[model samples]
Target: MTACKNEQLFNPDIRLATLDDLTALVALEELAFNYDRLSRRSFRRAIMSDGSVLLIAVGAQGLLGYALLHLRQGTRLARLYSLAVASFARGFGIGIRLLKACEQKAINTGKTLLRLEVSALNQVAITLYQKMDYREFGYYHAYYEDQSDAIRMQKPLRHMSVEQSSHPLPWLAQRTPFTCGPVSLQMVLSAFNPNYQATPEDELDIWREATTIFMTAGHGGCHPMGLALAAQKRGLSAKVWLSQEGPLFVDSVRDQLKKAVIERVHYSFMKQCKTEDIPVHYSVMPLAQLITAFDSGALAIILISTFRMDGKKSPHWVVMSGYDEHCILVHDPDFEEKDPNQSPLDCQYMPIARDEFEKMSRFGQRRLQATVVLRAN
Candidate 1:
């Protein structure tokens, strides 16, 4: 495969990988990694998948190195899934050329950010990434097949500019560990109704109305149905999207009595929603649908996992204010130790890449997805 003529900024030796390069890619993967090596089947899929691009560095001696880039669907975020340089070509600048080419391809495909995960112990790669202007954001525990941790890194690219929203954001800090859901609901309620008082008293009261019996530990968390009911009781129209039919977070509880209590509470919420004629869907809602609902003057409170933001696997709630082509703007209610140096403008509207938002919008091993949409009556 020859390099695309328009993308000839680098040496003509670099080109896109095709099915003919699958054997070479697998061989290179074997030479570069001991355990998490990509198999021939995986290489074949990458070469053919529309969502990914595989580029290779070639020379007179054949394949020198390769880089795999993944463009997430419905997002401006690209991920460098794998990068490897053959042992014989390590001293040469083939790795750097491959990396630069990958970045160019990402930009050409309308990506504003490129992210990748590297093993925590890979000092050489980490140094190279740092030199390339990639910054560490977070980490994943035991992410590799060998049980090694991985450090997540991201690099921003220059692209089309997105205008920030002029609409005022409602930002409120959670009063307790288990009150993020209620706080987020308060923020949404206030956004819809200027006179809606979002005080700590209302936050706790909403928690009392929506709290589940048990979460991973400590105090209980809010249920999607309970949150919808809470909003409805406050003179708002609420709709819920929950993927599971039974009680959520039940797997986190060990005792049978506690599990039964949680189940009963969930049933009560379901019965109430039905009696009140609130819409409930027993499946995950599409991102496009959610965005459409938001554009139609509805406010959203979504549950997400905090692992990407704070390295914890707890359920969290966030208020979705607006969206553009590049990112989804949110107002997070958990402002415990927000960077003091950050300005009010920064705290008001936090921008998260669309793909990252999707990954964070689920919790637990089962990947439970829940969201509640509300609008003033």
Candidate 2:
């Protein structure tokens, strides 16, 4: 029950969890959830681990609630792994207080954004998160042990709302799972070329040009070089920037044949960039630099890992449609939307903190960073 020292305490009663509170935390967690409950061992590890911020809310009786925030390595994002309040003590503002405390702890640890997943059926928790300005960014099907779906959400710690620096861009949903790159390029092209009309056929055609589907395993994710080539074919100029040089996504494939095919596609796309206004550069661009490029009347399509947005770990493509001091607005092409009411809004003007983007921009073992800047010829 000791108070955290030195740091600005968000709440006097909310303090970092210690091993002594493990027994009480387990009891409170049991009363709060029926499935997906954290074990005593997990609680002990989280309390002792430097990679997480485990906070507990205390009242006169005992431990009233607890929150576990897991920080991702080499990233500025933290996952709200679990949060639970005692049933009898729920009427008080303990839940919100504890939630805010978790956010403050995350901010103290240099995390710019926080994300979590809640059961879609839990409207109470969802409403609370919404009231706190956490936006629904993604969804997971049959995610719970009880067969309940999960709603993925995120919030920027520093800025909860999009500022005046944010700009609106045309939104287009990817018709297929692996065509985000083409769809993102289409979104960018629409901003520069008024004649450009995005269609399912055109989307697929763009994907074919942007992907190395010869692997035959299934749909191959699109790469920046292919995206640049597709934009060139559409009479748009492009400059592709990469964090690393050798063929991207090679680490994603283990089969020698698959690797060779991907490498061949990579070299082929690289060779094609030799002509036209498309040029490739091997360098990591900072978030500010990217914002500057987008502000220069150029549209930038960037690569990101969906791990922070959803629970998936696949490379995703999104267009940087807007940028401001607090966050960068992205037009994500991939979406799992069942609500027509919330459709399109879920994918447009989605604000992400610059630090979060820094982590999300790189994907996989090599931490591949790719940005395709587009302009009208």
Candidate 3:
């Protein structure tokens, strides 16, 4: 076991994720975001998948934070999918430590660039990236349903070696999977940092201008809260078509809505896309029935929980956006979620996958599941 350099050592014990790590990872997700909004199944898949690069930070209690990287070999850039540090330890340098670990992995694999997107309003991340020599490229408007802009940033690994950073990374002698225990709910929920990209007022503005929007009230609790914020922004009426399970504990869903309409279903599916707020004036069907839905979308979902990084269950929220065949997206919103103040012109998006499009239909999960035609003006 090659040890990290003395300067690089925060003494953070690190390792790859394995089957046994699923419970811990899930707990971490729950802590990092509202559990009402995360998918445990996705965590399981990510920990066990070939494409996933999962790294953990071990300290006094257990795990302090984790970094998940998605590698696309064809491109030299490794996407920093998600990174989360327990709330108690923020500013203690845990995030920078884990980030170094990821950069080392990228360099070891011969990757040249690391690309990541943060909420345009995330000054902390932006400052960190800038300090790390990451350059800003562009912004995606309404990249998120909450209608926040995504600030894309990149760091060139060619010029910066893993050793060049103040922190040193340990070498893995023989790559082995890690295992841990389930995290506590207290640890999961208490670790959130609500530094959303835009101000509450900005969120209200985007919501007001939106004529069409999407929701995932059940999968991740963010949708419902997002809907409420959207409604407040636009002064437009908002509605939620949830599965029969009732409301999420994410935000105050009980009365946040002018109308908390329920859209019951036969089974509880992940990321089901049902509309709300629009009227059912059509002879054909309602608007809630026509939009496309899925178990997960390409955008990030938050997870909240309480468990130490090493113990494997801590309070925190995470953000997840992309997934593959067996897994859905999951992530930590350690900071506020992606920004929600971009223009509708920036809202255009195609399905991340065409196959998933068909699969989502088979599962009855589309954003516009039902098409309703109103009386012509």
Q: CA lDDT of each candidate?
A: 0.81, 0.79, 0.41
Which candidate number has the best TM-score?
A: 2
lDDT score of residue 238 within candidate 2: 85
TM-score of each: 0.58, 0.59, 0.40
For model 3 the TM-score comes to: 0.40
Clashing pairs in model 2, backbone N/Cα/C closer than 3 A: none
Q: What is the total number of backbone clashes in candidate 2?
A: 0
lDDT of 1 by residue, 72-154 (tens): 54345678888998786775667788888999998897777777889998998898899888888667799889999999887
Q: Is candidate 2 or 3 superior in TM-score? A: 2
Local accuracy of candidate 3 as per-residue lDDT tens digits, 1-377? 22333223366688786667666666777787541223566556657765558888866566677888766422244777777776655676777878888999987875666777777766887787788878775677876546678887777675533221111111111011110000111111111212323233442343333211212232111233333223323333323333223323322233334123322211111123233334222122221232222221111112223222113332122222223332222222221123121122111111122233222212122122211111111
Cα error, candidate 2, residue 115 (Å): 16
Model 1 misplaced stretches (Cα beyond 4 Å): 1-157, 163-167, 338-345
Candidate 2 residue runs with Cα over 4 Å from true position = 1-162, 214-217, 339-342
The 10-residue segment with the lowest total lDDT in model 3: 173-182
Q: Name model 3 segments beyond 4 Å from true.
A: 1-9, 34-38, 159-377
Model 2's lDDT to the true fold? 0.79
Error of 3 at 51 (Å): 1.9
